[model samples]
Target: MSLEIAISIVMTLVIAATPILLAGLGELVAEKSGVLNLGVEGMMLVGAVAGFITASLTGFTPAGYAVAALAGLCASLLFGVLALTIGANQVATGLALTIFGTGLSSLAGAGFVGTTITRLPALFPQGLAGHPIFRIVFGYDVIVYLSVALTLAAAWFLNHTRPGLILRCVGESDASAHAIGYPVTVIRYLAVAFGGALAGLAGAYYSLAVTPMWADRITAGRGWIALALVVFSSWRPWRLLLGAYIFGAVMTLELYSKAAGFALLPPEMLAMLPYLATVVALAVIAMRPSRGRLDAPRCLGKTFRAGA
Candidate 1:
């Protein structure tokens, strides 16, 4: 491949990875605070529809993104209430939220099935972005850059800040955190809300930035992929970024194979490549002797009661 082709492939990889990176980072924060939200896919779907609808009506992309985040937050908050406050089973609650999000997004997006919107505005000037060398770095929309920034920020916050330390404490030992005067429940709620918002924004990026159109199930299991990325990264923000790109590269290969009509593989096998890679990667990690149980948050998927 020529330099331009290589750059184009890299750029496409970045775009493909952005949503997963964003969602995985958000989920990392929530998991660090001891919450396992399986409804990220649901939140993303709602965000996709909400963002698409708002953008279509208002003719403003940012407004659609804001509304999408809000929609996701709302869906996640419901999970927080049941799992955090009511002390419901976290896994079941997350599954139910996903189901609800699927139905609700489909219903809301029905009118938008055939609709398309203008792409979100880019941050850099077209002249600069179009330059061959410059385009490699500057051609992407703002969300792509924002996803990288968020990953770095999450790594910093988790490792350097006092609040980050406290959040980790809550995840490590909620009872101990409570004994030390930190409000475990409150921290978890906030973390979950942040995760939901990110998931929503990821969804919005699909309709508003990637495809610039509305469709049912637009995310197409990316939310689940995001969840897998969290595990694949061992819950580290930087690792999550790496894992997202790796997965994205596989997805990009699938796209290229289909578009080029590569006869070496059947269409069905090409479609399964990304998912197959995910399973293989996870299995490899699981097989590592160094990957102990302690790698994950101690309280992950466990609901905490304030008084208990």
Candidate 2:
């Protein structure tokens, strides 16, 4: 490929990876605190629609993102109440949250179908952001950079901070954490809310930056891909960034192949590439030795009861 083509491809890859990276980071934090939320897909959809609607009406992308994060936060809190407070099965509650988010987003967005909005602008000045060579490094919007920063922050917080150690303790042994006077349920609620907010912002990236338009399920299952990415990364933030980019490359294949007029595979099959990668990655992880899977938090998906 020509240098320009390579640059274009790399730029596309970054855009494709940003949402997954953001959502994966959020999920990683939650899992570190011992909560397993499977409704990431739903949260993304809700955020996408909410962001699109807000931006469409107000002509401001930032407001849209803020609203999207709040929407996701609300959805997650519902899950926390059911799973943590009411003692519902975590897996079941997560699934229900996904279903509810899907329906809620679709219903709320019904009137906004086919709408268009201004794409988010790049963060740097046009001279830098639009330059042929420099654009490679400076052309992206704030969220792309924010995703990387969040990765570094997450890694540091998990390994270097006192609260981080406490969170890990809760994940490994919530009963022990509770016995030590930690508020297990409260910590998890905050983690879940954080996850939901990021998931929402990731969804907004789809509507505001990737496509600049609204449609049903605009995220196209990227949320599930992000969930799988968390596992594929062994719950490590740095690995999650790497995994998101790898998946991004897989997803970018569909667009590049279509543009390059490669007809060896049908368009339908091309579209399946990312999801196929997700399944394959998950299978590979599952087949690893039991010890390899021990990187996951010990109390993952377990409901914590204070007195039990």
List, residue by residue over 1-308, the lDDT tens digit for candidate 1.
56877788888988899998998899999999999999999999999899999999999988999999999999999999999999999999998998999999999999988988888766799997788878888988888889999999989999999999999999989999999899899999999999999999999999898998988899988898898888878888988899999988877866665676665567787666656766776787778898745377899998787778
Alpha carbon RMSD to native, model 1: 1.8
TM-score of 2: 0.93
Best by lDDT: 2
Quote each prediction's TM-score: 0.94, 0.93
Candidate 2, residue 306: how far the Cα is off, in Å? 1.3
* lDDT agreement with native, every candidate: 0.88, 0.89
Q: Estimate candidate 1's alpha-carbon lDDT, on a 0 to 1 scale.
A: 0.88
Q: What is the lDDT of residue 197 in candidate 2?
A: 95
